[model samples]
Target: MSIALPQLKSIKIDKFILSLFSAIIIAFLFPTGAGMLHLKQVTEIGIGFIFFFYGLKLSFTEVAQGLKNYKLHVLIQLSTFVLFPLILLGLKSFLIGLIGETFWIGLFFLAALPSTVSSSVVMVSLAKGNVPSAIFNASISGLIGAFVTPLWIGIIVSQSGGMSLGDVFLKLIIQILLPLVIGLLLNKKLGHIAKKNSSKIALYDKTIIVLIVYASFCTSILAHMFDGISFLNFVFLFSAVFCLFWLVIGIIYFISLKLNLSLADRITATFCGTKKSLVHASAMVNIIFANNVSASLFLLPVMLYHITQIVILAIVANRIGKRTLNEAA
Candidate 1:
């Protein structure tokens, strides 16, 4: 006789998610060891290559095809870069009082991030969404966020920390944008190879992300940055991230319905619009909050939201997939 695991036990968790939290725990326990200057150097180089590989994967033809749905694209992008930030802006005062200014700024930073690339596409595809549009939005959103995220943060975070807007932009250009352009330029030669090895490339991205997380957390713990955060504060931050996520999800659903979007388009909008890029968040934090004591605390909201979205969207996508399968039957 064969037996199946209980449904909850059977649910598959991404290994990378496990790796992410492991990195954090390790950072906390072995903070001194991982906080070496050499690890920092390796992390920077790894970040450049992450964006470089990302650019190599983007196909101009796919982007052109996706442009036909310009209205949908605009809506998703606005929801990503504008609506999310505005929601956080309105809640800033309250959140600051509850969690303090550092965490509040982190929340705002999370809102300003772009839609995730791989996970957004995977969720949309699983939900029987417009795969091409999802790919297009996810790809372009990162480039847009490279510029807009810094600008948004600059308006609030003063140059007092020696992190002027110009300094941030310079780092952005050097670390993220320049490598991306080089990769794009070489895409004709490398794109097919990159596509064929996409899984390997994704592994590289995940590895680098884990390294960055470990480094950030190590730095923060060593600096005693999280000493004041209580268990209640943790609960509040988790709740806040969940609510922010659902707010974007709800608004996107309403807009899709109002526009009479097809089921696929609706799914694409929902997944892409509501997600934030942890890759971009991790890479940007190195530059944006470099050497800052609270750098890891700044990552708290983004990291929590990242895990929350993946778990929630996986279930949602599976349900949508089942419903679509039934309709065909």
Candidate 2:
């Protein structure tokens, strides 16, 4: 079989966008109607690989490099795990009343999830930001999510009667934290091999992300995730989130400029600090939403934002990134 073919290892990460598009097309053409059961398991493995490769790809050096950007990292992490959630919490007083229970809960839970690591780095890179530091911020964000996400859920969901805080806390410590710790500790040896085969490692990454997306979509269909909202309502809600993203990135941009930071740093902080991870969000969904209808629906806002951010960031990253680099030249 050594014949003319597209080299898998040579395929750029960006091409995975087509893989995602293909998955979407396949689902639409078939409605997940036949023999898609295997996809669920495959997605599960993908998810596992996603986290595993995440561990593999990350290194002590990258982590040490992140420590130098503590101010930026803290701001991004706090914005993700704190500022945004608090904004949603404050808005809860009025927003929930207008949106109804399901939509409100979806919005609420969405706010509580951690900043995604790789995609944050990806988006930051697209925006011509400090890629390495963004990676650190994102990696730490996942570690933080192991605690922060569950804690937020526990405190927030108490009024909703979702689940016991302590039990969930214990489970998060065991399931989420343990693996990451093992990976980190083993990084010296495994990291080399993992980094060497980053291409294959990346397949694991995409597989996991796709699985999460598919599973969440499946959950949505199974649980009537789209219930009670019209196309108009989805439009409105998505707009609200879009504006929310704008407001966030906009604020970060101004603050960075005001602080007299370099354009590179500003772009880094803006993109890294502004968004949430859908992958981590999905992983933690069951904790927050449980059997709630909003668990599935919550995904819509993030997905919408993810796509929009990528497109806009790509344009901005390329334009400004070039100008900044040119100034140095």
Candidate 3:
């Protein structure tokens, strides 16, 4: 008997999406939990674990071999680290009064972030896209962003009080680079095992992200972070984030078509190129914005963009998968 393939399900409202709202609600209702849990320390350790496992799962050999398609890689990297920021920067004058300066800074930070590792690969696989390329690009994007994000921010923000670029780099080294190096060194023996248990690792990744969201939002709530902002401001912020996501997706699709890429590569480029990493955003904010009262405001746009991209792309990926299956059959 032939083995049957797994059935693909259409996207719908799901618990994962609901959990995002739940995270915000819980944080708002019980701001004290953040302190009781010592979330700051937990988040620090969790951030390290996130990168460590990421390094463990990454195979440098596979990443190197996959880089043969230099054009696709370049397009994706530029879209993520360069073009996205430029677009926001171009619109900065228009956005300041509309969304206020603080939210604008948050939006800028969101654009500067790298493409996500887990969700990008998941979306590509679901769409029956270029899995290897997605994996390679997502993994490498983080490494590039670890340095590039701060450099971009430094040009725009001279200083956040006493926190300087030097301090940011120092924290990056201790928190991100050192742990990543340790994991990479450990990868020689542990890579295969980590790869084998990827599903479990993904669950771990999401759990840590949720914890970070709760902690960050809780702290913001305790400080009455959103009290000053009106409901209209949030509505406008959501709209801006929604527009940004679609605009990037459209650009990636058009560029892939222009370059005459393969279907798989096109899907990979569209999905991976358009993503911004919530993991990096959550981890980096604690270091970069250090002790800034408006830290939660910086996270607002990121959370909105992350949620929007996931929901929209999941539906798009499902449709693509169904069409591909029908074409094959």
Best by lDDT: 1
Model 3 residue 310 CA deviation (Å) reads 1.1
Query: Model 1, which residues run further than 4 Å from truth?
Result: 1-6, 159-162
Quote model 2's TM-score.
0.82
TM per candidate comes to 0.95, 0.82, 0.91
Indicate the worst ten consecutive residues by lDDT in candidate 1. Answer: 154-163
lDDT of 1 at 160: 47
lDDT of 1 by residue, 62-106 (tens): 877787898789889999999999998898889888878888899
Give me the displacement of residue 37 in model 1, in angstroms. 6.1
Model 3 clashing residue pairs (backbone): none
Over 4 Å off in model 2, which ranges? 1-48, 122-128, 290-293
Give lDDT: candidate 2, residue 71. 67
Error of 3 at 44 (Å): 1.0
**1 versus 3: better lDDT goes to:** 1
Clashing pairs for model 1 are none
Q: What is the lDDT of candidate 2?
A: 0.67
Q: For model 2, how does the per-residue alpha-carbon lDDT over 247-290 read when each residue is reduced to its tens digit?
A: 77877777777777766677778877776776676556644454
